[model samples]
Target: MAKFDLKGLLNDRSVPDRQQDQKIVYRNPKDLIPSEENFYNTEKLERLKQSIKLLGILQPLLIENRDGKDYVIAGHCRRKCCIDLLNEGNDKFSRVPCVYKTSSELEEDAGQEDDIVRQIMIIQANCYRDKSDWEKMTETLKMENLVKELREKAPMEGKTRDILKDLIGTSSGQLGRYHAISTNLCEQLMSEFEEDRIKISVAYEISKLNKEYQKQACELYEEAGILTLDDIKGLYRQQEAEKGIPGQMTIETATGQNRPPEDDTEIPAETQIERFYESTNKNMKNYIIQEDKNMTIFMLSNLYGTARVRNGHLNYQGTTAGITFNPGRVFEHELSWQSLAKILIGKYGHKKPIKMVSVDIPEKPKKKDNEVSGPAKCITGKSKSGICGAAAYCDTEYNCCAQCPDDCNSRCGWLEERCQPAAEIPDEKQPDFVEEIADHPGEAAALPVMKNNDQRKEWLRNYKLWGLWYEDKNIGVKYYKYDFENGACLIAEEYILPGTEWMPEHETAFLHLVGGPEPECKGGIPKWTYHARYYKFPNSETELVEFLKELQK
Candidate 1:
């Protein structure tokens, strides 16, 4: 029997030319509806550059035919890079391959054009080339363009509904949040939000207040310099107290404070939604805790949704995540919460719902819907598996699928008993199985935990032991070493004590430092190693010392 060469056959296939009979070859990136966001964070750009470097002009720059030349369609970044390369005399810059694009080119005049597509190319570039503060401004412009488009399309029928779905590859809900930001906030607050001193969601909330009241709130936030959501609530209380209201749960204290409403009449629903958005939105600000090669997680909110952690860096799924408890950002509004969850799920893996502390006191809402259910949830002895964790890790291990008699795969947290917390084990530890997902057995693979390409957490623990380990109750200290392809694996900094034995069970070499009091390198071999050689990273004696310092701190 003759065997067909799949790889050779596939690679050998030619890209046949498109039909050009009487057909009008559509040319313009403006016509295509992108399937995903052009999130050009650093990693993506490197890939694009590598591709451009490796395979010159494989994909053409899509453009609309304008007066006999190509008017760029979707690959703006490639165009810029082409120009850059040409200016630098790089031969690869001569020609770029592209797909003919079709988009609502007319929308450019009507305010509903294709902006994300054009921007992604630049994102594709900056993600690896060079990033500046202008990226933030670029994001602001993209956000403004979307707002304008929403305003134009929103008036026309059948648009708002699309905002809920992945329309044009953008989360319409997140777009709506960006669009709604200034509409619900004031100029001063908006400006502060741009500087990141205060939060966008918080500004949105204040925007809901009367102009005069919003101004007053902005003044308070600026004056405090360091502001918390509770501080804003306190200002609200101060206003009520000035009005001689009896008592209200406010920022001054957890206990009921003296603050009376001017009138018992309800606040507007618009006002309530705005307040909810602000409180929840402040839960994140581009913060990060760790970085490896495989993933990047943004734990925007605390376990119970009270606060947010802005960002984290990662290369692979470094073994840290195997033991690390990174949570998600939660918000008050249903859409934002869902959208944040969606992005989190799509990007990093899922998380566990955090149990928050409760106020344990009763308070009336300024609006009817502003009940305890509105702002935050206090997690007691129970925990909810994070949205992704629920779908992946939690469900399979606890036999949660057993509850869905008809369909185990369905999303039925309410109807299925297994969807809820398990009774057999503590909610926090119930879904610890990474293999339960069956697809990515090396939960710690990305974390550089798979030292010898063997699936186990033991290597990661050993790696952790290579350096000093310190846990800060306030700052939450965690230490790790892994690849940087995901984003950040800080081995470039130091390696104080790589300990004593030189076991070479694996193909790689090892060293055990003689000065350590006890045997540090007790293990035979690491499960995973990202270095060309272990000696490479701990390059200088000073860096090694600093690594030890991080361990103690």
Candidate 2:
């Protein structure tokens, strides 16, 4: 019946109501301490910002009473972000509330040990929530320890333990090996490995090698590039097997040259970081990612099994080239606008990002003409359009479609107008293979060339009916305003950028989808977008044949 001790009862909930059990609130970014609490990547922060904006505070944050003020009990990251947004003049955040909890089990809000209680409360809450996963990781580690103990007691089982589960996929012996890898990796990497960054098999192989060897392999991987836990183990085994091959790590310097490390040498700039605090500091991250809404989505193809994909954008190419490259069919995590972006960075990319990772490729110094730092790009090849020996357009190795016989540059031939890349060919010299073809993509049937004016008119009408254009002849940019009440036309005051820079993406397709959230225009066809050009939509062969038949009639 007291107004003070509200937080204590929720700690160990007897009844089964989560809301009554706990309250969560979005915390301000400034108030929250980002050291050692959680992994606050850019992706996580962006998601936090969006959720806070859309829904009013869904939960109250649990904070400790530190020095008469509440310190974060659990959701410190959210609190910090909210504060950051509020500082930027966002009034929307002032409403978020925090749950008032007594720091001690049986104490009032005004207690000296309140801050200590708050920290314990958070640790206890996290511990309780993490019990299940914690148990799994612990069990895996314990089992691994047992294997090591038993290996001394039984060698036959220990040595054969790897092959039994790896090749056949059926063995308790495999579980022990998994336990060994899970335990062998450093606590931070172990947590990530458990979360799936390093596969168990890969970690197991790493664990099998000597500790010094494992460290060597990890360093080599950092220099060469990110290695999957399995990849790490493979490299270790490979190097060990090669007898006198000696260890190697290809380090890329600011000079844009890759120098291989000697067998017993230490990397000059390499340092070990294994915790959340060290990774999130300003010195280790980008100050700001300049947003370019001009992320041009050239091709939007909805293949039968996959989600509609719209790729093709370019980042600056300096020493390192950052392009999000997703070239996996067998194993994929999440398929979302932002989620899929992290997967496409192609490999050996440095200072790499996770969700919205920046691609990395060292720039070639002009002096190192034949440097060949990473891998050799085939300079010349015969283009498939019957053109002999030219770099078949597959210029880049990471994202190039293997089936494509043309160049890998974003602006490919035949359909060159839409996806515009930096380097483009003149329209005069562009491929003209489409006109000679018997059929086009839209109809699934062939159409004769426009033999008459009537035929062309019929085709145009059919095109209009298929949502490509309006019924009225409202082609091109519709200018001016009609004052129906006054029975007169008036000069429309449009804030039009009076220059040629406003050109659309294609001549055939209008309005030009430069990017998203296109504001609804009132001046056009009653809520319709004011397109810069008319889209020549080929409806179908039936529409085409029907239009031709109408022309004949």
Q: Which candidate number maximizes lDDT? A: 1
How much lDDT does candidate 2 score?
Answer: 0.36
Tell me model 1's lDDT, rounded to 2 decimals.
Answer: 0.36
Per-residue lDDT of candidate 1, residues 1-553 (tens digit): 2222222321232222221212334332333333234433332344566566667655554444444555553455555555555566676556555554343222332343345434433232233234333244345446446544545543332343342231223355545555566466667676666556665546545544565666678677667775566666555656665555555444544543533222323333234322322443323311211122222223433232443222222111112122112222122222233443333333322122222111111343353221122212111222233223232222232233233344544434343334433333334532332223223211234333232323222443255434422221222222233422322233211122222121111111112111112212327642222232222122223333333333333
TM-score of each model, paired residue for residue? 0.27, 0.27
* lDDT to native, each model: 0.36, 0.36
lDDT of 1 at 359: 16
* RMSD vs true structure, all candidates: 34.4, 33.1
What TM-score does model 2 achieve against the real structure? 0.27
